[model samples]
Target: MISARERLLNYAILIVFSAAALFPMIGVVAQALQFPDLDAGTFRDAWREGHFGTYLRNSAIVTAVTVACASVLSIMAGYALGVLRLPGSEALFLLFLAGLTVPTEAVVIPLYFDLRTLGLDNTYAGVILPQVAQSVAFGTYWMRAYFRGVPRSLIDAARIDGASSWTTLWRVLVPMGRPAILTMVVLTSMWTWNEFLLPLVILNSDEGLRTAPLGLSFFQGSHQTDYALLTAGALIIAAPVVLLYVFLQRRFIAGMLSGAVKE
Candidate 1:
């Protein structure tokens, strides 16, 4: 059992980190709302001037496709490695794990050229494909760990009941694994939505193909001296991710903590 003192210390640490994380956001909100005359209609003007509608559409398309593809691929790969224990699975798992160690910057130059050769550069596909690959690497590791923790008896019982591996996974395991799956989705969504570097490198030539973070950068450059507009644009770009976490906080926390205790 955790001691009272330990619990208190943990809470204190969390509180400190939470405040540290939130302080800048609070400052941005304050700046966004300040100097009524100068700041008046700043967000609206920035939105229109930056052509955020186009950027948002591009971001939505990239993030949605990336997350959807990554989630499905990760789930399937996780099942194979974690449950089926496919031949050479450990080597395959390690190969996927290698992706986590490779920094994006190291590969972006080669990736840019590859996408250009494929005629995908300056296109949403160029940004979406790389981010999807990154998300799947992490997602497969996460889901595999969660799946491996399932009871052997449960899996055996599913097999005894004449269920195919696909049915057993989708019906038996996936239902029980909702928390883990939802957590992965929420995380992947956040990463995809906030992605900047890939979009910057791949879609530099196309303003209409820019994602939210990329658009915000250009917005900042244009409004270099306008703190209010800059802050407002930042908030606008971040609001979707914030709202996603707000709605899924419970499942996200539960999924993160579920592995802490074992039966």
Candidate 2:
């Protein structure tokens, strides 16, 4: 912990990884602003050519709703697994984990046909419903790990105080789970926001349903030569995640630690 040489090496590694991860985003910014001169015209070109406003609003809506659903579902399912001593619980938990292994593509063909039958294809709910299902598997796993770390005495005390299961979960466990909850929110938001394959497969209309990722595809197709607009679209999609991580780094790290370092 006190080695200067080790710290230096770590920083060096960080710089290298940071550059590698940031380049694609930087490249997109360079293209969106389209200043071959790389000057002040970036915003002007982006606003003129990109439908960033619409895409931004759409991404916000879908990401918010789906994440809300995923976080709620994960927290409840995770608590049930971590503390509830129901019969055959281990086998049922395995079932949830098994859902993690099933590829979304394998299910998409059946999903599409079913959605079409229900007239849900191209609907906002259709796009979000499948993503919620996918996110729940991983979310439940992570939240379960977090919940397992919480002291059982806390639950016992709550129960002794005449707290019902629902009261204990909401009033005690949920508050203690702030870090894990935030982590769930961030993960689900990013996954849903960046999701392209699902939206592309489920949605066929440009009318009321195009996620930012899917919209970016449309932008790229229409303006293949217009690197500036494409770059702007890319930035529009990426900015929120970057800002979220930067601002919530503490909570993210804390949540991850709570989940992984269970006693």
Candidate 3:
């Protein structure tokens, strides 16, 4: 039933749209490959000559911890709000929703002072806790939507089978919501991996911890006007996120669409 003219139009639209979206990435890769010509030898050299191995490892550590903490907490929080009939549930849920409206900058000042007082600054716990807090609201909202879509009949069946509350969540609800969990993992990993502002403020030492993103900034400052290396650093910072998205785009789409298609 497809016409030749319609096909041509579709291809034209795709070419235009895809080109626009791809231009930045195409340019970055080209520049990185060009080395200093694209930016500077020092900048490109930072990834090659500098301690990128350490930066990558630190980033992975922080991202893994953040994602794990956010996923478990979000799943439990969302399940509670979606399924439990406790009093003041609406108020507690609103608190979670409020997290979405909060701007990180607004809280950073207070956060910094608190961490300093508690001697958490320059520590992984300090870097991580704030990121987790920032992510919790969005995570809870996404998870709640997904959990809401799970059939209540499933919960009833689990109860009839004498499954405990925790057992039901783990054995039944969590399994059914794999799509949403994968989506959360992707989102949290990307966010933690690329986070800058909070890390910049909370972290004081370059020793034992320097995220890839933080290192990119340091690389830029040290390299001065090196654009090629800048691109290379960007590639380094972006690689994991890009790879994960490419591999998991299907689950991402399914999770996000699951939220939208449900009530």
Candidate 4:
């Protein structure tokens, strides 16, 4: 349907954009490799000096818990709001939408104090809970849209087969919504992993509980002049999310495109 000239032009644009995006990443990797001895063990040195093992473990714990809780809550809430059409559902959906509008900066101070009062400060729960709430806000919105777009006839057929609502959701819809669910998981993981402010504020006095981004900030402060170490540390913090996206790129893209074409 398209002319060869237009297709070539599109390819040219894509290549240019891709190169532009990758250029800085390539530069960082190259700079990280710039060691005096050319084998100075920059990444190893950075890892040991930065104490990234603790930070990364903390981050993994927080991200995994947040994503799991948020995904489950979001799916249930979204299904209720999008499919069940319960009384007052629209109002409740708006409440969830309101959560999305509130910036973390606006409440981080009060939240810290409240968590401190509850003895949750400086703990994994402190970091994980707020992030779960934040992710659920967005996740509910995303999954609601996806569920709303699911064919009504398909749902009706499931119901006719003596499937309970819970069974229908788990067996029929969730499997069919794999791409959408995975897309949500990937996004929530990235956001929780890279979160800096929440962990910084909540775990201020607890070095052992620092997340990757918070740890990287301190690493940068101490190694200000050491570009190679800094770059290596940056890469180390970023690698997990990068690998995750690369692994899920196809599903992620498919989910995004599906949303585009659906309601």
Candidate 5:
């Protein structure tokens, strides 16, 4: 048990750090509402002027498809590597890990040219595919750790009950690993949603296909002196991610804690 004084000190420290982190965000909101009456029309004006509807829709499509494809691929690859222990699985797992090491900047230019050659430039597929690959690399590593930590007894029981590998994975392990999977989904969604470089390069020719972050950059360029509109646009671009984390924070924390304990 901790002493009351120590607990109070810890709380004080946390409060200090939390305030430090929150002040800037609060300031941004205040700056965005700089009008005398705190008008809400700034956000509306930013939305219309920025053409954020199209940008947000494009971001949604890319993020959803990337997360969905990456999650499925990660689960399968992780299961094969973590649970099945397939031949040369370590080599294959290491190969996936290599993907995580290679920075996007290193390959993005070539990737753009490749996509162009394939006639996929300025298209949703071009944007979605690279992010899916990136997400799957991390997701595979994440899910593999989760699967590897699952109780061996559970696998034995499933086998004795005549569950095929696919059935066991989907019916037994997947349900049990919901927290871990959800954590991956949230993370991948955030990364894909925030990705600027990939979309900037891949969709360079298509203004209609610009993601929110890219749109915000161009919006910022045009509204260089308008801090109110700028901050409003920034908040609009960030709101979905913030709302997502707010709603899923509990499960995300649980999954993180569970992973740490298991590992």
Candidate 6:
């Protein structure tokens, strides 16, 4: 157990880091609120002029589709790798794990050409598909570890009850794995929403298809000197991710702690 002195020291460190992170955000918020007649009109003007409404919609669609597809694929792949007895499953799992090591920048240039060859460039499909692939890679790794850590007795009991693999996974393991799964979804959503490079390369021409981060970059370029509009636009783009983290904080923390304990 931690002593009172250790706890106090830990809190002190956290406070220091928390203030470091919040200081910039406080400045940005203050700038947003203080400029342009010292009111909230900056946000409205930034919203209208920056055309973030369309960008937000595109980002929402891409993120939703990518997360949903990646989660389903991850769960299935993880289940197969973690529990099922198949030939060369270990090698297959390692292949998925290898994807986690490959940096996005290394393949992004080639990916652009490949997508262009497939005539998917400048389209929502182009952006969403690549991000979905990236998300699935990490998601598979995450879910596989969680499923592999499940007790053998629990799985055996489910099988003894004459449950099929599908039923066992959905009815038994899935319910028990809610925290892990929710954590994975939240992480994937955050990654997908914040993704900029894939969208930037794939969506060169279609402004309507730009994700929030990409749109924010373009907005910044046009409003180079306008800090208020820039900060407000950033806040608008970042709000969804912040709200998501806030709402899922408990589940995310539980999942992370459980994973750490298991490790």
What are the models' TM-scores? 0.95, 0.87, 0.86, 0.91, 0.91, 0.91
What does candidate 2's lDDT look like per residue over 30-75, in tens digits?
A: 5555556433475456645566777778778888888888888988
What is the descending lDDT order? 5, 4, 6, 1, 3, 2
Tens-digit lDDT track for model 1 on 1-263? 99999999999999999999789878877776675753547768878988888888888899899999999999999999999999999999999999999999999999999999999999878998999899999999988988889988999999999999999999999999989999999989988998888888999798888999999999889889877677778888888888889999999999887633342
Model 4 stretches with alpha carbons more than 4 Å out = 1-27, 33-40
If both were scored by TM-score, which would come out higher, candidate 2 or candidate 6?
Answer: 6
TM-score: which candidate is best?
A: 1
> How far does residue 140 in candidate 1 sit from its true spot (Å)?
0.5
TM-score of 3: 0.86
State the displacement of the C-alpha of residue 128, model 3, in Å, after optimal TM-score superposition: 0.3
Relative to the true structure, candidate 6 reaches a TM of: 0.91
lDDT at residue 53 of model 6 (Cα atoms): 95
Model 5, residue 73: distance off in Å is 0.5
In model 5, which regions exceed 4 Å deviation?
A: 1-24, 33-38, 261-263
Query: Which stretch of 10 consecutive residues in model 1 shows the poorest summed lDDT?
Result: 254-263
Residue-by-residue lDDT tens digits, candidate 3, 1-263: 88999999999998999899779879878766776465455545756754677888888988888889988899898888888746887799899999989888899889989999999988888889988887888888888888777888988999999999899999998888898889888988888898988888888664558788887788778877756566667877778888999999999989877777466
- Candidate 5 lDDT over residue span 1-263, tens digit each: 99999999999998999899679778877776575533578889999999999999999999999999999999999999999999999999999999999999999999999999999999999999999999989999999999999998999999999999999999999999999999999989989999999999999989999999999999999999888788888899989998999999999988886665355
**19 Cα displacement, candidate 5 (Å):** 6.7
RMSD of each: 1.7, 2.8, 3.8, 2.4, 2.5, 2.1
Candidate 6, run of 10 with poorest lDDT: 254-263
Model 3, poorest ten-residue lDDT window? 35-44
TM-score, structure 4 vs. true: 0.91
- Weakest 10 consecutive residues of candidate 5 by summed lDDT: 30-39
